[model samples]
Target: MTLSTRPPAVRTSLPARMAGRLTRLTWIDLVVAAAVLVVLYVILRVGAGTAVSFNPARVTRVSTDPADLPYYAARSLLRMFAALALSVAFTLVYAYAAARSRRLERVLIPALDILQSVPVLGFLSVAVTGFIALFPGSSLGPECASVFAIFTSQAWNMTFGFYHSLVTLPRELDELSRSFGFTRWMRFWKVELPSGAIGLVWNGMMSFGGGWFFLVASEAISVSGHRYALPGIGSYAGTAIAEGDLGGVGWAVLTMAVMVVGVNFVFWRPLTAWVEKFKNEQSEATDVQRSLVLDFLRRSHWPHALGRLARPAAEVLGRAARILGTDDRPLSVDPVRRRGGDAVFALVAGGLIGWGLLDLLGYLRDRTGLGVFAEPLLLGLATLARVVVVVAVATAVWVPVGVRIGFSPRLARIAQPLVQVLAGFPANFLFPLATWFFLRTGLSINVGGMMLMALGAQWYILFNTIAGAMAVPADLREAMDDLGVTGRLRWKRLILPGIFPAYVTGGITASGGAWNASIVSEIVTFGGTTLTATGLGAYVAHATERGDYPHLIAGVAVMSLYVVGLNRLLWRPLYRLAETRYAL
Candidate 1:
């Protein structure tokens, strides 16, 4: 009865305060931050000390010692990051342009399908010489070539991801942005980007994995009798395989694993966690991922100080954007001008196609003889059959598992990084191992090659399905549970439909990746032993090795046609069905 009518004074225990501070200093956080700083220092030191002498004669110089692993890894990472940065920028621009223009979308989507199907080896064969010549007399030339090759490996799928996300933005939000009179730039930055952020981040991660998948071919390139070996883990691994040094290969694999783990900690994990804020769906089941490095950065006083230092530069950029930004208003174009532009575009495209066709036919008739084309066509059909079978198998296996793991936040958190690292394990590096096993077991190259292709491509389906499943709304699950929806009925009625869009996305990318992987998988070699499967991939690889440009071009063209045709005839229809029938 005698308690004063005033509030009690708040008190904080010293132990509690100490515990609060300690919570900010996790072991994982400290270790990641320290390792990252050390990596950056080494990268900068190596980059600066290494001159950019574009001497073609010096391009062959590379270290194979185990001690050089760290430096090589650092160099490889720099190229990867450079390629990734370029890929992101290309995605933003290309996806936006395609999304905004119906005319462009008609041409661009099919172009992308064909481009993605063009083997990485094809890019290496065609682009290496051009890139080297672009910066003649400088080491930056070959470096640029390698980075560009990785960029080709990484960019197409990410562009598709962003474009798909943009096209699939919720109708209500699209209308809202339009009603708010958002400018083109403002709409992109706020609406399109944030709407697409989740897919873009996931696909970006996959793109990086794809880059690593082809890193060896890109780094240790031999095109048109010109060999260039850029010092990197990829080159190290390639050399090990070439020398038949199993121990060296093991060491290279270990080094790659370390690099992948470090990359996940420093880049993907933090980015994945941070981009969760951009998700448009408000679902209790959609738990934002946590990253130790992100937590450390947020808690560290230096980052805040650095932000303050960067404020002026950011403001300048903001001002420049505002000043340069165009209005979002739609203009009524003159029909005459529009028709004229369309006609010109059509005429130029027709001429180019005609010329290309003529050249291809001439080469086929004169160099390859028309009779030889049948062989590749038959081989391509076999490869296509293998791709279809492998994709179906992967879908059957991964869909349910991914869905279950995704539904559990704890499990998803645990699995995401592990899967990311596994996906980044260059599938080609294991080719030698597979070859050895196949030789011992006397397995058919076709069967073994399909397995390798599946191993390389199935992660696309797995990871994307996990992402889709995790995004499922908590209320939907709860409602299904309350309604006693379980077993086949639950999946058929709720779960499968919920994840259909993601499954289609994964399926499309996986199929394309499988086609690309066929090039390496079908033509396996370890030291003196070479295993060649009867497929278009092996044909391309053989042609590449022999510097037979006409056959190589023919094989790549046929593969691109098959890929684009399949996407148009199969995947595109399925994608439409997903968007129209099952989109969440």
Candidate 2:
């Protein structure tokens, strides 16, 4: 109409406009955003209540309202996450130290072994007193103590995982890193960390499972005449059991189950899937795990936005690190100076050890005679016997089953969560029920305790075996199939050798956990009745309750000795054998 010189009006198409808008929003995006908001609200609510007075007098006076369950759970989760963060940091430093220095490794590795073998209850006893004194008159003190206890339960295995990974890194990769002239810091972040990620994640998951078994004991602490009932699911369960409230117990169990599932979905699944990138054996055709949450994060604009926000701080950190970093060139020190330093270190260490031995001897002589150690030693032997039987039985039962499940990817996907849930279930929760049955049926406490230990420890063997089987090389599997390997011969020649290393790792963890669980399992209480078995765990628990510090220390020391001895003599040898003969 008009052949007017004016240009036609530019218009945007509806589909194009809609597509632009859709790029900013997906179904997963909305879901994740909503989840974030809810989590933030819960965190704020929990943080608000954390301002309570640190009155030791009020530690035992805790609320048991069902409506407070969510708040309590949030608190417990905060404590656990805090402890886990600390554990991860500790593992990185401790493992790096051990891996980088042969001199330190000799001391550090054995020290870690002893530390891990120390039962959680033993740590709780010492930690509670010290933390309370440090934060006198504040709830924060006991809270810190509880977190420390959980940390002890979680840190050791993760440390071992990282250390083992670092030490076992392929020689080719090590040489490559060195040839590239990577600085120490760069090598750690780029090479060592990635190489160890898979083991660290798996062991971290196992550590979390182990932490749950001690959560109740940590939260509802009653040692050295100090009773603290922290507001958490653990304390809720304890209160429920004390009052015989079946409904409360059911509620607590349901809440715990929900929490475990949520963690698996939101944290572990994503982590496990993400760490596949770090696997040394990953091939182009390897079907890595997929997680919807991880996928959403990867695909969404949120990651880009977060990266942009963090870039400035990261750049600052990088600059500072580079400024302070040492050169990669090897340093040549005078032989005389090096020898002097080594001599000084040796003398200091010897002096400390000698002083400790003298102090320990004097304390034992004055407070508790040497003869008094005989009872706990005998009790330790009894516990050791039970651990041996339980581990043997668990290995027999779970090895074949785990191998079978591992062979089926679909079955493994299903069984993994189930096993995790089972592992997370606190053995103490079953004590009241088991105690009732044993009391009614007149079953021996020793037998019941052994069974309970098995229940607590079997998951380690099963999970490790499953992982070992699943990790079997696809080429090896194909070769076996082509060779027509089957039946007992297949298991004897292929399966056992393939999983031997993993089996040794699992057995060590399971044995340690069994010893720890004995503190709870060897002593069961239902109402006014208490059933105790003659074992080191029972000895420690009784002494702790009585506030008998001397015996408590002695019992813990004895238990530690046994654990260290067995690990050094038995597990260490087996591990070395596996590494030399069976490792892929």
Candidate 3:
């Protein structure tokens, strides 16, 4: 009767069907996209470093006037976030590769250990020259170099966190993916990513914090006796430090406080809340993570519109991905065949490593002689002592505080913003005043340097603890409650076990951070005076400042050795224990 009234419905053509199915741009989506485009346009036009002629002699005009601090702060944040984006990209790829195969993991983990230990200055030594050459005559060259240096500070921690997540992925999630016949892309997109999301977010925050820690060094790049200071809060603060302007430093701190608050509200809070749903909680979490920004955005249609727009590209990539890896199938290989292949690979890799070591030894012996190794080894020991002290102190102070904050949603809401701000409070911010105070008190550099190192590395511990505590299953907590577990008993059984893997991840990065930070922390400057501790960091800094490449290489080499050895001997074992014994 309806068809008769409508004079018979005509069959839709393919094009007509497609047109009907197409997503029409909603008003809200258009509004959101327009706003986003405007902000992007602004970011590209000016905030993305000005392109200037490649001048190796260009000296940045760092103005310390409070009037100029806002723009300077904005520039610094732009560089930071740019680097953060790159770091995330690098982490996804690198950590995935390292996690996928045992053979690769063997090499990659050690390489990563050394990489994270390489100080920011070590990166600048090569990055500045290389990037400048690459861009030829663009301000973007040095800006890229600065961003890359910040990336060096941020990427490794994120990579390690992601790698840990991949390796420690629960057995059930993997089985679920396989049972559903998910393609590799689907598995990674749906199961693996969600499982890792919590750790990755927290680690990303720590990585951001590390970027802020090294901002001064990253922005104030020195190569071949020429200083290329970029227009940033770091550069502004450096100028203030050079002039002994405590007021200027104070102003920089104030600006950073404001910036941190804004970043927390705009970026991190939304991310935290968004990741909360991805969390693998066993029973309903009554204390939900919430963000006003996330809530507001959920009310808008932009994200869905964007997702729809991206669907075609995603489908193409998914097909490409399926060609390489199995569609969530259990990979069965002949053990003998795999072993044979692995052995051949190992032999070739071993040969290359041996050759490289021999070459390095030859070069070092010809220049500084074999005896050059002795001093750095001793200095590395000194630095190691300081690292131990710093980690111990940090673990003692922050574990309870972080755990308490994590378990209490109300406290977490209040404390997270503060921690985010404080975590990013660059240790260098205190160098002028703290250095002055230390000098005034006539304290040993060992005492003062340990304190400064703690300022940088302790946040790693705190961040991981909170992430770990939040991840504890609600059902487990309920069970503990039913069993009348209290205080130490609760901590010993559930809390400690739940948090162990995360703590190990944090500890590894924190330890590495301390080693990396020693390059800045062990060498303090105030006005025209420089105070140096008798440690590998001081040696590396002294070498870099004076253009002594041979000693610099030796100092860096020894430091890497220390880091890699410590990781292989201590951290890696603990990591394995965490994976096996404590993993959810």
Candidate 4:
């Protein structure tokens, strides 16, 4: 046997080389970028009343009536913008740390695990007081707090996506960066961030949906016996639900669907396509090959001037590095160091459990004769029951369907958009049909509401599992096929195991979404009668209506504890399985 080795071809023509060197960015594009920045600044300054006198008093009154739709819409848009910026920043920071520093990765990643598991309501309870105090008599502070609540709803999915991308980069590419002695900052910008782009887009889409799920509670706050309603889309939804107006709810749903579609078409599609161009299949750039960005910088007078200035700064940095004997070698790693990771996670879990117990004991002690604690425990049980039913049903239906879709790319394309539209459909859109069906069939309102929660949460598992299934290596699939795998045997032997990690990711997110959606789902009203389920969601909704703080806290606490416990017991194990079994 003999082995043959040959050198690869390189570009010969100057024009062909130049065309490849310069990425095409027109002057019009630069103008557009500048215009966007200018317009955003102007809007933030004037429309938001931030740059001028900045008077909350002069910001005009916020009416609870539907007549104030424009006011609330504008506020919601502002908060959405803030949420996007914060999500991007946090994702970059967390993803970078998790990728580059093992010690920081060990501590922060698990803390993020616990933080993400905590509900948006739980976040509000802890932060609302300090957030409000930040402005101390300004309405803007409360407004910003609402934005932070939205941030909590959106940030976690993005963090996970970025973390996954960071850990999963090609080893050859990582080694290449080390060989070149790329600076930490250069590696982050040129390598890590761009590699994470596709995952970030998907996570960003999920996070947007997550934000919408909790919009109602995030904008409306109740703490320490006080009720504060900020102007936003959530308040709009809450009002429509309260008034039993199907038409109004329909309008809101339409607006959301339009926004989702527009965002996907305008932003996500192009971003995905661009990222795909840089995947591992793409040819590597050699040093002898010219880059357009470099050529452009060389030709431009401004860049030449900047380079002249930067040379001295670069020299200073180099000298400092030499004097300090700084090494640029890549760090060696052992996955077994995750043992310490598990210990840190256990400590956080123990603390949260202890806090919940203390609160429960205090409630019992303080309300011995008043019977206040009774409602919370009963409500907690009802919340648990609803979660169990919805999750069990959702998983049963979505898991098999997801595996099929994953195996067929054409099916996945069709199903993905349909799932997106379905997920975006608000619970209120189905309220009329649900109310009518329940009334006609004499079914309890509770079951109907559970349907709404399940509708939203179920999709997460299906889509995520499908993503996981698609990730199964072609070699593995071919091997199974060659072995004559079919039907249940295929699912058991190949498909289920392949997509289990994605299922866990989806399930974790969906479970949290169900908890948030339940607030709206567990309470039903058609016309004159309001049917309330025996759950924390119903309790909180009712309390919000009557401005009852003690009961609201009780409901929030009950819901948060369940969410935390489920994450620790169920989702945590699944996450470990994914990391160990399927993670790249």
What is each predicted model's overall lDDT from 0 to 1?
Answer: 0.82, 0.80, 0.86, 0.66
Q: What is the C-alpha lDDT profile of model 4 across 1-584, one tens digit per residue? A: 87767677775898876676455645644555575698587566535642222233333333445566655665666776678789989988887777567667766666666666455655676567776667766666667778888898788767876776677665676788878987665566567776656456556766766666666667766554555676666666666655777776666666666655655554443443344334333333221112333344344444444678998886776666556654454465456666676678768877987898788767755755336656866877777787788888988998888777666655654565666667655565566667778888998866777888886577677766655655555567777778988888988877777676667767777777777777768876655656677777777777655645566666665666677788779987777776666554
lDDT of 4 at 149: 85
Q: For model 2, what is the error of residue 290's alpha carbon versus the real structure, in angstroms, after optimal superposition?
A: 3.0
State candidate 1's TM-score.
0.88
- Candidate 1, after superposition: displacement of residue 440 in Å? 1.4
Best by TM-score: 3
Tell me how far the alpha carbon of residue 161 in candidate 2 is from the true structure, in angstroms, after superposition.
1.8
Sum up the clashes in candidate 4: 2
Model 1, position 213, has a per-residue lDDT of 90
Report the candidate with higher lDDT, 1 versus 4.
Answer: 1
Off by over 4 Å in 4: 1-74, 95-114, 125-129, 164-197, 220-231, 278-378, 400-417, 428-433, 469-494, 525-528, 540-558
Q: Report the Cα lDDT for residue 283, model 3.
A: 76
Please give, for residues 56-119, the per-residue lDDT of candidate 2 as tens digits.
Answer: 6654755667788888888888888888898999999999888776568767888887898788
lDDT preference between candidates 2 and 3, better one: 3
| Weakest 10 consecutive residues of candidate 4 by summed lDDT | 282-291
- List model 1 lDDT by residue over 1-584, tens digit each: 69798888879899998888678666655665687798788778867633466566554755668999988888888889999999999999998888887667767887889888999889888777787777777667778888989999889878877887777777888889889977666677778898777778888888899889989888888776667888889999888888888888888999998888888887888887787677555455445578887887776655665779998885665567677754523535678887887788778877998998898888778987867667778899999999999999999999988898777767766877787778888877897789889999999898889988886689888877876776566778888999999999999998898778777888888989999989888988889998989899898888887788888888898899889888989999988897778765
On TM-score, the stronger of 1 and 3 is 3
- Please give the ranking of all candidate structures by lDDT, highest first, separated by commas: 3, 1, 2, 4
Ranking by TM-score: 3, 2, 1, 4
User: Number of backbone collisions per candidate, in order?
Assistant: 5, 3, 0, 2
